[model samples]
Target: MVSYTGAVTPGGPAQTRQAGCLTITKLAVDPKMSNNAYLLQCTETDELVLIDAAYDAPTLLSLIGDRSLTAVVTTHQHWDHHRALAEVVAATGATVVAGEPDAASITEQTGVAVDRTVTHGDRIAVGTCDLTVIALAGHTPGSIALFWAGSDGQGHLFTGDSLFPGGVGNTFGDAAAFESLITEVSRKIFDVYADDVWFYPGHGGDSTLGAERPHLAEWLERGW
Candidate 1:
């Protein structure tokens, strides 16, 4: 029942939020990378799903103590985003889920096959709850975001390197890629969700749609 500030520090305590039927815990791992990992647990059944096993398998395992991990959902195939994937999946025996386009690359890089490939509009069940897959395909060929519309009427989005506070994810100077990312983020995200929707990015602290909405035009104009 603690207030969910969505703030976390590498190697520091996790910030947990209780939203209606779900409990969301955000932790920052890999001090140098400051990567953010999210644990979503269904309050009714205690079934858990990990979003982005970015680093430190030991720490991630400890956080999942005694709980059943239903799946490890990788938001993308970025190396830094799945560093602990193989180890975590090995320890927990959880199913691995990733965007279809990047699943092969993820498996190639980490040696752990993706158990399930998801696309936009796909629903991933976590016990009694469900996370809607939102494909934001620009940062990578298969970058994705997860959306949970809590019973409390609040929407929580986990954007993996696709959408951030100040702007969208890095497209590495690829104009076409940037366009894809920005367009998807605008149509699929900003246009659909309300201002109060809270978004958790791949790295750094969280942000609300309203806080970042005004800058969307600026970001688009700046083309970055």
Candidate 2:
């Protein structure tokens, strides 16, 4: 719904209907790249997980404080994806995680060491909700996605920039790599997520896993 309450408190707009189970807030950051960053909060346990800190130190800090954040997770190492990670990590004392290749870049940029370098089949447990990591590198060397499987049963994905709604991401720059990435994303979408799963891209509004699946044929036919 992308609801916005007041612009003063900082962070994303928050809504809590049922208590202590699920709290999801989607934040928007200027990311220095093409997309915006997101912050996910599990309010019941006071456990927070941020996906890409694309803003500055103060703004990120304000958002973290506003949400009672617990940890930070990056989908990739694009400048847009991690512009403010170091600052947030320093302020919150949160553990930062990224794909293995992105680990070095994140460290180089943020100056905050990455505590976890994940690969395919890795999982990040947040209270009862679990985020399973899947390598979907095409947009960059260490591009990845996080699949959230929880009681909601909706199945959510954080697809960095490899895949979007009706259209996939650009592949002209790194055609081979980008093609491989979209293929990987297609495979994951084909296997792990159900038709109803929600796909939250790195830059746009949300779409469904099922909704985008049929378009894969078109993507492939276009030489993806």
Leading candidate by TM-score: 1
Separately for all candidates shown, the number of backbone clashes (residues 3 or more apart, or on different chains) is 0, 0
Q: What TM value does model 1 have?
A: 0.98
Tell me the tens digit of each residue's lDDT in model 2 across 19-137.
23545555555533435556676655667778887676676676567555667888887677787877787778778888998889878876778899999999886656678888877
Query: What C-alpha lDDT do the candidate models reach, one value each?
Result: 0.94, 0.70
Once superposed on the true structure, which residue ranges of model 1 sit more than 4 Å away at CA? none
* Tens digits of lDDT, candidate 1, 127-188: 89999999998999999999999898999999999988899999999999999999999999
Error of 2 at 131 (Å): 0.9
**Candidate achieving the largest lDDT:** 1
- Output the worst ten-in-a-row residue range by lDDT, candidate 2: 5-14
Q: Cα RMSD (Å) between model 2 and the true structure? A: 3.8
Q: What is the lDDT of candidate 2?
A: 0.70
Model 1 pairs in collision: none
